[model samples]
Target: MSKVLSKEFLQRWAPLIVLFSLCIIVSIINPNFLSVRNFARLATSSAAPLMLAIGVTFIIIMGSIDLSMEGVMAFCGASLAVVMLQFNSFVEWGFLAIPVAIVFGVAIGFVNGLIHVKLKIPSFLVSLGIGFSCIGLTMVMTGGVRVSASDKAFRLLLTERFFGFPLMVYVAFAALLLAYFIQKKTALGRNLYAIGGGEELAHASGVKVERVRIIAFALAGAFYALGAMFAVAQIGSVASNLGTGFMFVSITSVVVGGTALMGGIGGVWQTLVGVLIVAVISNGMVLVGLPTYIQEGVLGVLVILAVALATNRKAIQLVK
Candidate 1:
């Protein structure tokens, strides 16, 4: 009984515990890890991943997974750059590019959800197919070349700082707040949890499971669009590879933050902790002189450990 209780406690608090523990361990190794400057940098680095994780959190809570982030992000980033370039800057009418990018993402996500729900296809497979298609479309649009969106006004997201952190961090925080609201205060959010708990039961309870799933996916795409904007801002350019590596980072952060891949067990707040945890580990590893390969290995191990502790194995008899 004691052992079971301990496991439950750990599962409930693992993300927070892991975050604080990583902070302490890294600070001990390199005191600079605790410095305000380093923290600011970490916040900047974490902003994009946080947005991506937040977007995916909704889908995950619905017991579905989205592997379309990389392709979606890249396509959106490229689209933003191309659209902004048409007007030469983010001033006046050029600002329209932002919404255009977000709407594009929403459409893509809507279609993805529609196919998944209507065609009886698996979520992961459907998303993966759409992701690849998006990537191919992006490549065609850009002619296999990088598009530059270095407009000074738009780049302010990364260049300009207020209160010791970049504006992008604040934007990410705002996104987080909105996502939290949708997840907690809205009917859709409640329905998501209901579906995740058990889809058939949710449908039997009169919940419009299919509609909620579509909306959740569309909302996630909007967040991914925001992530793409931040990613472009951080680099001042866009390419087919603009979203490279985000898949590993965002999903890892989401899971590490304690949102179970099996779903119905986490939130955006947890995703925030997970993003910070990943940022700290990556930054700390660099500060301590660890090679890239080792950092990757450490992250993989951390994900496995987090899932092990967070998963209620007894509740899930079939591995699937």
Candidate 2:
């Protein structure tokens, strides 16, 4: 009975409970932590990581990892600023820049999927190579200079608030909703879990594992593109390192949200809670006056704890 209860607790309530505990601690340390203003700021800050987490959620669910988002995001940010209405821009596509950037990212995703699925390359190696290549491309594009695209309209996409929250928050919310829809309502989503849980069995059952895997990476790419746009909107500029820290933060969000690194056991809602936890921790640390350097330690400990709790139920004889 104790074992059963603990398993249920870990699976059904651990992430939420951890999130609430963090909220309570932060609110106690800084009474103003619960204020609407701070929450709005938190929402804005979390927008980019949320999208990245959502994108990778499907990939992780399919028992694969893609480390190329950081590169993809940086490349897309450059593309958006260069093509959109901006200072020093080569074109003035205005709103069209967003979709164009997204498509560029999708193309990259398709390549990643193809190499991994068809060539049988490890997803990890493929994504890492792609990410490095993208970073190189970004540096070449800008010649080591940051591009500032202070387009008022683009800024408005992030600055304009409705119901006390920025439009960027709504955009992130929409992304979450769409991710949930995909997870629950689509065959692609279903195949992802099947693949993760048991790829050989899923393939034997006619799940078309390769096709599903490719599409999963493609979806992840599309989300990475959107995340790049939001990142630029939040800063009003595009830098070669605009995606500098996304890989760690997004992975941390996915892990802290109770998603297994081993895959097949989590969904978008878990990732959303994870994103909020990360945002709050990042913001709350400042409010409570924790030293900047110690924060990484805190996050690392939390991630370890989350992973330990999640994978504790079963033991593996071998790990690659």
lDDT of 2 by residue, 165-215 (tens): 989899888889999999999999899999989999999999999999998
Estimate the TM-score of every prediction.
Answer: 0.96, 0.95
RMSD of 1: 1.6
Candidate 1 least-lDDT 10 residues? 3-12
Model 1 clash tally, residue pairs? 0
- lDDT (0-100) at residue 255 of candidate 1? 89
Model 2 worst lDDT run, 10 consecutive residues: 85-94
Question: Of the candidates shown, which would achieve the greatest TM-score relative to the real structure?
Answer: 1
Q: Which lDDT value does model 1 have at 22?
A: 88
lDDT of 1 by residue, 255-313 (tens): 89888888777999999999999999899888888875676677788879877877777
- lDDT (CA) per prediction: 0.90, 0.88
